[model samples]
Target: MTSLWQHARRPATRDDDSWSVAGNVYYGTGRPIDGMERPFSPEFEAKVRHAYKSNGPVFALMTVRQMLFSEARFQFRQMRNGRPGELFGTADLALLETPWPGGTTGNLLSRMIQFADLEGSAYVTNYNPGRLKMLRPDWVTIITGSEEEPSLASEAIDSELLGYMYDPPTGSEPWFLLPEQVAHFAPIPDPEFQFRGMSWITPVIREIVGDTAATRHKLKFFENGATPQVVVSLDPSVTPEKVKKFQALMDSDHRGVDTAYKTLYLGGGADVTVVGKDLHQLDFKATQGAGETRLAAAAGVPSVVVGFSEGLAGSSLNAGNYSSSRRRLADGTMRPLWREAAGSLAQIVNVPAGADLWYDDRDIAWLREDQHDAAEIQGLQSRTIRTLVDAGYEPETVVAAVAAEDYSLLKHSGLYSVQLQKPGTGSGAPSPTPPTTDPEVP
Candidate 1:
């Protein structure tokens, strides 16, 4: 039997169907080709890290991650007639349950999705063939081959060449990983590019940057020695030394949170004048609120779903709109992402032919209302079945017609008969009896 490790380590076949690069392929900028967009360089990553300082992006990211990780269940399924038949036990189950020896599947998936969201790509190598070892997106690069249809780098290097060059942060020499050895997940893939996937942060980087700046400004406003307006006018005759001493005195008396509200007394004919704008006047509230909305929108997360303070606006607060927003987020944003991740994971996991990975969202509280609605609909179906059966339709026919939504079943009854009696004819009078005749008389 071929060992799992050998199966994973075997270099990708260089055939027409294979996704192998023919010649030596070097990394090109390691960036998505969105026009006028910056590459996923070190500086860009720094800005992404800084964006976390802003409450909006953090909330959005957290909301997405938490929702995706929670209320999700995975199982290996058997394939029958090109459809998933039932949950079946496979080696993939154990691997997914514990992606790494120490890590849980949830944690592993969370890290992969988080990296994919922030860095535009996530690469996790199969260490010792099938065990997962997540590679840092920043340190890894795709070394392509000469052929446009890329082939693996065959030359031996210091480390194993699975298909990627991994340079550890602790000043280690670069190593290689096979394409099959790594599970790459990308949310928004560039249509033209093969190696890179587009990041959600790309479209919203502007909003995130604005939100970060706004948050910083607000922080500074509170941190500065002076509040909105309390100008201290000093005597012209006072020496520069005296001015310095007075400035220090005021700072000591009323700077920062601890002494912010304390009163200050100025001698030597100095005066304190109230100045232009206070924090309220500047309205960081509305500015930051707008920025938060933008960030959430760019992230494909509704502000209401993320529970942002500013998201408590009228539309979001309304029960109907809020429900609609939740559905939209789940359907439009999270479902597709879940499908993408499942598809990628399928590659690493030994998914049997005709069977694919799928997500079960039946347990998600956010979507429980849908279940409630379905129950109500089923109740209506039950009522319909009862009415039809009571009206002389076969029980099977009624169930098939109302429950299955297949009217054809109604006519499939062996009687091949139609009822001419009008509805509510239970009390109608019966016709007189006819004379009986024996078959032998004919």
Candidate 2:
């Protein structure tokens, strides 16, 4: 709990003289948001939204064009789609429509923290994998069936789980990517006939679809589990050929889409529709530093960016974009904004989803990285940006404003870029329709 300001320096690390800057510069700390619960302020969104529309749009226009369209024309499409009026009015974001469970207690923010504690790490929805276990026995069984890692779950006919869970047919796209938890709990539940244990599983299934195979999968698996000889039948939800087709479209049409969520949502752009399994773990990573090079180059909105991100890979694109830019000022000091952010990580707000790095108001958010999503990020970012400008900051002061919202914004390499205003060469291009709203809000 000792802060960098409190510690006397040993005077040096490596070849740098940042002795005084040691832990002081790290941007993750848990802090309290003073009046985040207050009503939405209009001015806040205008400036922040404008910043995103301008900066992020150009970046997004740049990338989606080469990948999806041909430049000049695409940027035009971007503008047309970005008409603020279409998404919102001239006011700040909508009166926060927090999810069911999130609206209780003091509010969503408080509930988000509580869920993180009860469930271990912060996630974006009431659909928390940990919580869902009680609702979806198939997931509970598949999850309980493994001792593989700390974060794991199982479910059939549940696209949500299929996004993050792994089983026999977990082909090419990789259904299991997070494992920080203690993994593979003892006594794995029989994938079939397991839904019976979860009181909510049956209903969710019946509602999504009538008493079809998926329902039967839940019914027979959970209901007949007690019967040895007459148990439910099991089949890979996504057949091999279908998996191949899905993977192809995923790679070509929906690249950068968060696979975990994608497995649930299943497509891309404004046209993407979601279905299937119900297995998605949440890892709340939400900022890429308060507008640093990484963020700017990618044209990410300073507030909650709501897009999906494919897991990092050494793409031909990324492989060729390395840079040598550094932001140490003449006096060997970083921007004051950066300095400030490093000192406060836990209190950042409106953090976006699919961010390379995000700022936070709580250190615990870091531990939940596996299942984090766009909703948590957007919520934090949108709200925080509003708080900053409302306090009398100018648009030019966006970086400082974000740093003020939560110091962890400095942890991002973008923390440096927002200062520089030049997206480094290597960061991937911007996304179109910019992946949006996390699992919770939408």
Candidate 3:
């Protein structure tokens, strides 16, 4: 098949020694006839990483995602008459299993999810046939081109995806890869851009900031004698120098968790009035929990699944509710991500003629309940197949009908079973002794 890049003009190349310098030169230089480069913001990605590392809820949510996503292994699945058939393993899967030397499928998957969550996209390239390399999403640029002359105004409609450019931080010459050579996984689409993704965290950035601020407040509360602020009044006769010395002494002696609840000595004419509310009055739990829930919601993970305060409190921890939450994360979030990842990675892998790349979650412990549910569903389908076959439907068609849940696919044979047939018409019944006796008697 002729590739899109083959028809488009080649992008102008610069002999600049530094990739950053070339990038600066090309920045905002209107769309080239060859291709337009779309780069992710490194600053935003850095902030995402900082949140992942510093925020407890964000960390937990992403960790849960990575842990579950990595459990699914890649396989080949063929479509049977527009429906998915059984998944079969292939040698091509080996590339994913051991993407790089000493790197397991889990490592590769973790990196992919981490990058995707952080930067809103993940890029993988098999520039070297047998080995797979993950490109830093922020460092990689998507190259789009069009057959028509490039115009800034209509670039969105006219351009077609050409390939990718990987610019390393070492100021080395960037490597340009064909679309087929790179696998781009962007689960969430960016609203403002074409052919780009937006991070789940983007929507909940305010929540994250709020949560971090709340955490800082809690730490400060503890650091400040673990008590609320108090207003101190002194008599007019007291010297300013004396007040300053007394204030310094109070702070030095009473500040921090270790000195909390210590006895306070007040001299004559000194009065301390309690002013600020304590942690209980402030309701820190509710404050932070609300933000955590919002973050979890954005991540498409139930707060319960990540053990957030909101999820663990009240009825959320009930067995049924917890189970539902787990299912939501597994089915709603992880499965879709895995599906997208498989499809993206397929671009670089040699897929079988009749098969597409897919993920197999049968072995994942987190989805054991799903496996049980599947078994029950299979059993029901088996009963349906048996009933249809016994009703004289073609066995193949019966199986297909049961599998697809479309009874219209069933085809009946020209014969019926004994129960379905009228009294003596059934083949199972003894035929009337027609011949000799009847003739003789007649």
Per-residue lDDT tens digits of candidate 1, residues 43-120?
A: 335534555433455656655765565456567655544545556556666677777778777777777777776667
Prediction RMSDs, each to the true structure: 10.0, 32.8, 6.4
Clashes of each: 15, 67, 1
lDDT (Cα atoms) of all candidates against the true structure:
0.63, 0.25, 0.78
Off by over 4 Å in 2: 1-97, 101-106, 119-442
> Alpha-carbon error at 2 in model 2, in Å?
52
Q: Give the candidate number with the greatest lDDT.
A: 3
> Over the full model, what C-alpha lDDT does candidate 2 score relative to the true structure?
0.25
Q: How well is each residue in 1-442 modelled by candidate 2, as lDDT tens digits?
A: 1221111111111221111111122111111111001111121222123322333322342232122111000000011222211111211111123224334212433322222111112222122332211111111111222222212222222312111122222344312322232122111122222311111111121121221223234444333221122111224564678667765654553343232223324333213332333212211121222222233233212112222232222341242221111111101211221222211211222222222111222222222332355567767877866654544445445454353443332322232223333544323535335466677874
Supply the global lDDT for candidate 3.
0.78
Put down candidate 3 lDDT per residue, 78-154, tens digits, no spaces: 77667777788878788999999999989999999998887788999999979999998867766666566444422
All candidates: TM-score: 0.71, 0.15, 0.85
The weakest ten consecutive residues by lDDT in model 3 span 19-28
